[model samples]
Target: MTSIIVFYLLYLLSLCLGLACVVCVCVWSGHWRGGFAWDGSALEFNWHPVLMVTGLVVVYGVGAVVYRIPLTWGQNKLPWKLLHAALMLIALILSIVGLCAVFDYHNINKISNVYSLHSWIGITATAVFAMQWVCGAAGFLLPCSPVTLRKVLKPVHVWLGGIILLLSIAACISGINEKLFFALKGNATGTQPYSSLPPEAVLGNTLGVLIVAFGLVVLKILSNHEWQRPDSRPEGLAYTPLLQEENE
Candidate 1:
């Protein structure tokens, strides 16, 4: 019960943070700037934060915890695995679209691309996630794969997933800081810089905190062995010994 409570609480917190991130980006680009667009305008840049939050933060979070839901624990694992992969694929597609938008905007404006620490880490994380998904599908989802192979790869998959999540969060933080610094730097025409705690700065900083909190809560939930889903196979199964030994 305590695990369930904590899970739901963190789930709610993630939802709130997701909403806050959307609202912050919308306010910053729509209200404060001019509005959003896809035609290489400043508004086109707004899609970056919005889609990154949706894909990396929201959808990825759901994918990470899908197997932990109690309702899914009693069901056949294949369906759950398919659902997990589908959610991750959707997240990856969203992330690709977000990346395209940013790159297009940069190209249109003649700005250099992939030049920042945030871009470097973000691209690497995306590439690693794509590779992980492909390897997972080939190893675990294929019927021809041996059970031993699956068991051996399971731990690797879980750890890589967790690491990818952390990388995504780190990229997000650095991206936010980069954007905020750029905004502050461009405010030289004004009497007061963004150091004065403008509404946009406050919203950006809050979004960063919420993102970090969401990642930490997710890590905590994932690390709790008590909340892990149990294997659905019955006793006396051929793979039972392998799983038991691995668990031990």
Candidate 2:
């Protein structure tokens, strides 16, 4: 019961942090630096951080915890799995849009793309996530997959999902830092001397902290073996033998 309570609390905290991150981005871009736009302008760049936080951090976090939700434990795993996949699919689409926004803005303005560490890591993480989703669908959702294959892929899927979550969060932090540096230095002019913190800088830093906190809480919940859902089948009839055979 305590574990369950902790789970919900952490879940709530992560969500709150996610929302805070989005709000921070909106305030930083909309209120501080004009507003967001899709056409070739600095405003178009705003969509990058906003969509990334919404899709990669918030939506992905919810999908990660879907299996751990207590209410879904008594039901068949397939429905939960489908729900998870659907959420992740939406996340993937949003992430793609975010990536495209940045690339388009850069191309239109003749700015170099994928040159920074943040861009490199973000692109790599996004690629891995896409692969993870495809592999998960093929291995688990497809009816043609054998039970042995499914058992073998389960742990890998879980671990890779966690890794991708961390990677995405790391990319977000780096991206935030990069943008803050650009803003503070006054793009192409080098006006300010990194002395004091502006409101936008403070907001960006807060967003980064919230993102890190959310990732940590979600990962803690995911890593707790005790919080894992039990099999819906009778204990004796569970797929222990199949798992063991695959392990062997």
lDDT value, residue 145 of candidate 1: 62
Q: lDDT of each model, Cα atoms only?
A: 0.77, 0.82
In model 2, the Cα lDDT at residue 190 comes to: 44
Clashing residue pairs, candidate 1? none
**Clash tally for model 2:** 0
Please write out the lDDT profile of model 2 over residues 1-248, one tens digit for every residue. 98888888888887887788788877877886679999989999888888888888888988998889886676666667778999999999889999999999999999999998898888988898999999888877665666687777889989999998988999999998888787787446543523467666777888899889989988998999977988756533343321222211
Report the lDDT tens digits of candidate 1 across residue range 1-248. 87788777876776676666667766766776567789988788888877787787667877888778765666656667778899999988988888989999999999999999999989988899899888888776666667787778889999998998899899888998888777665455552456777777887788788778778777777887877887656543323321233221
Question: Which regions of candidate 2 are displaced past 4 Å?
Answer: 186-194, 234-248
RMSD of each: 4.4, 4.5
**Model 1 vs. true fold: TM:** 0.87
In terms of lDDT, the poorest run of 10 residues in model 1 is 239-248
